[model samples]
Target chain A: MESGQHMLRTGRRGTLFEFSMALRDLVTSYHRRGLAWSLAWHDVVSRYRGSILGPFWITISMGLMVLGIGLLYAKLFGISVAEFMPYVAMGIVFFGLMAGTINEGCDTFVQASSMLSQTSLPMFTFIWRTVLRNLINLAHHAVIIVAVIIFFGLWRVMDVLPALGGLLLTIVNLAWIAMLAAIASARFRDIPQFVMSVMQFAIFMTPVFWKPDAFPDRHAFLTLNPFYHMLTTIRAPLLGQEADGLSYIILAIMAVLGWALTFSVFAITRRRIVHFL
Target chain B: MTDVSIKVTDLTLRFPVYGVDAKSLKKNLARVTVGGRLGASTTGATEVTALSHLNLNLRAGDRLGLIGHNGSGKTTLLRALSGAYEPDEGQIEVRGRIAALLDLSLGIDPSATGVDNIRLRGRIAGMSSKEIEDKMDEIAEFSGLGPFLAMPMKTYSAGMQARLAFAVATAVEADVLLMDEWISVGDADFQKLAHRRLLNLVERAGILVLSSHDAGLLRLYCNKVMRLEGGVASEVKDIRRLDELLAAA
Candidate 1:
């Protein structure tokens, strides 16, 4: 974030100064969109090279899990397959995006240790690099979601449009969480595993497979889970179920407050990342 | 104002040598506020003053060589100039764009072919995609990898890898050029070509700061040299007296 006037400086400062530092990093990263994009693309390409199915392998494995789990969970919950299949598929796919992003975000700067130490690239560029990789994986997973919706004859544009809106909000909120996770993991070294265990437990806790509607008595507490709100924002509308206004409100608060907290952490830790590496 | 310049005043950089326990979240959470304090002590950490009160100044057409024993902060100063590391206390003002060959193999992934490594390294050197694409043939030709450019860099010999690294590092255009160590690569033939190319790059840039252990190399490429020891620096000396400087050491 140093200016080209050839001045590079850092010091003790107020909250506004810290916030501006983080904001400046994002702005600088935005200007160098080409470098981050190429790095992310290279990562995706190199990861799957020589594999026959390439990235679709992620979709295929996810597809099979949805099928097996949908059938069994539907029978267990005593719901019809037609109605339950799309819900399960949507839940798994979108939740996978959220969880995968958080998990990978833990390694964002840690994996870029060389680049951080060697180059003058902006710090947030690595944040976007991790986000882009997850988004790419989501594209592959979208294949399963699209096929399930079409096969189940649940293709109403009206419902799909609002669902996409919620999905966008979900993505916005997750970026802050992922960014915070990246910084924390860089410092602590065990945050990635910690995030891993949290996501593992969070899947069941967040209603990815089980229907939130099934447990009427559980409504009050389920709404307390921020991730449940993250899920229903996208999943509910597509199922012809109304996602309560509270869900959007909660997600909105998360996006605002989470970013505020993340920016402060990022500002404090920005220069020290080289030492951590 | 000079087109290319570097200014440093009372620059300091210090960081802890973290122990395994200090890096653990559980251990940190256990001691709570006590952990960070414990980390500053001998059991958990050793604080390293990588550089202290280091002051330097350079302007356009300055060719400065840095000589130091291992761990004497040669790379640290280069990194600070590259903007990868900020000053801990003082200020470093650098005018104009910088191309830092701090490490030749920094972005050179062995799994990538010679062509792909060119693109990756070019981008890191701050080259735009179009620039890399337009210069692709020239870089490959200069590396002399020829048809072997299609194969993974891992398959190439060490000399070949050095050729590829050198070609990409010197390709970028910048007002300030910072190089760590004189790169010696390939057979005698390739070394001559690489030396000429490096001389051209150094001449084109407004300033150059090179760190090397070879005295003859310093005499050949630099007009002045500085010695560093234990995070401190000796006064800068002229190249004509490099022989005396080395003798004095």
Candidate 2:
């Protein structure tokens, strides 16, 4: 009887360890594949579920913004419609993606509080889903990019390959930033408001409407801004211009560091986040 | 030896409830952090102890019932047992996969239909989408939700919602079933069905711990009943154990 009691005690301890490790394992495993296209596609479909036009709403809204800004800003910066159109188009697409992903990620847990507190799933799934959903929105805006180039009659076929490379980099960069922001926003309630304010500031600061050359001597300051590098790399390639290797390197380093920091913070605070909620 | 199913020694949990703002609490915590009492004023204030040096042990086949008043640490103990809250002092060792059902309303997406929500909930429970798909019909039939399964979960009534949620949870087998309260089924028919299902569940589990205010209902289901009085446990001998006195009459 005494030996049996000891064995029972041992089994209970094993169960406790198993329960604790189960959650940890769930999180690491989910992050392995990140977000898949199918899941993101579901989010996009669910977003405009009741709407008649569906995803065309994104296209129409983007087109009007580009037309209004491209016409006004082209004259303000002394650039022709031909040059301004592609810049504004690429700017709107990339910025909209960055803004949407970062802004939405802020409330990643707050929005999913009902789900997380009760369900035993890894928290990272929600973060990746938010990022993927916004990427779908980005895909919708790509139509505007194609349309703008065609309308301006500056459609160089060679720009396609370089544009593809720039888009790939933009996606990688946005993924890292979104992961970092999602983790931070989940921890700090004020992050979404802060991200929105930054986005409002970045729109004017980024060279979306005008050329970097228009800024002349102060152009170096534009290079210093991370958004500036992101904007130029994505937009420059679309405009059939060479992208700076140094800018790509800097952005890549930021992406790597951002991921490391975000994952570490997420891992440490994973258990405690539910308490704050 | 069979191994210890649960061992909690001197476990204590304190939850800080600040009045209005954390500023006052912040100062008190800072003092305590630097090896000082939280001043006389703060010390004189009311502090509720959720759990005080809780010590518990359970072995296989122990279907224990927790009885206490509103603040008598039943829910706190359940959370601690499930690893949701870490004890302030002492360690807990549990030996099986605990399927905790404090709130069945979690993981249901408002926008998703019952089917979609099932997939999401199943995924959360580590079920692949395909696995959820295979069990989807079984869950739907078991829930008895019928045509309403296609509608969004938001449209379902509270009881209907609970049925779906409970059905999905029961689909996954559990070694240790921790129920907050005996789940309330919708109607007489549903209640009968739920009773049958619950009995089936109780047979497979190694240990079952349920917290409820209805001592009579607990006596019906649980083998041992322990009451939490003044932050300490006092086991209540089974009333049926007094059979000799009753039989003499």
If scored against the real structure, what TM-score would every candidate get? Answer: 0.94, 0.78
**Model number with the top TM-score:** 1
Candidate RMSDs in order: 2.4, 6.8
TM-score of 2: 0.78
lDDT of 2 by residue, B1-249 (tens): 133277777776665443333323345457678665545654423345677777788876677887777777887777777665655566667776566777776666677788877776665555556667788899999999999989998899888887887787767655566778846547767777776776776666567788887656676667766666546665434535423222322
What DockQ number belongs to candidate 1? 0.60
Model 2 stretches astray by more than 4 angstroms? A1-45, A75-78, A149-188, A216-220, B1-49, B52-61, B81-83, B86-98, B226-249
Docking class of 1: medium
What are the chain A TM-scores of the candidates, in order?
A: 0.93, 0.82
Candidate 2 per-residue lDDT, tens place, A122-181, comes to 566776777778877877888998787787765763366655666666667776677566
Each prediction's number of clashing residue pairs: 0, 16
Candidate 1 Cα deviation (angstroms), residue B122: 1.8
- DockQ for model 2 equals 0.20
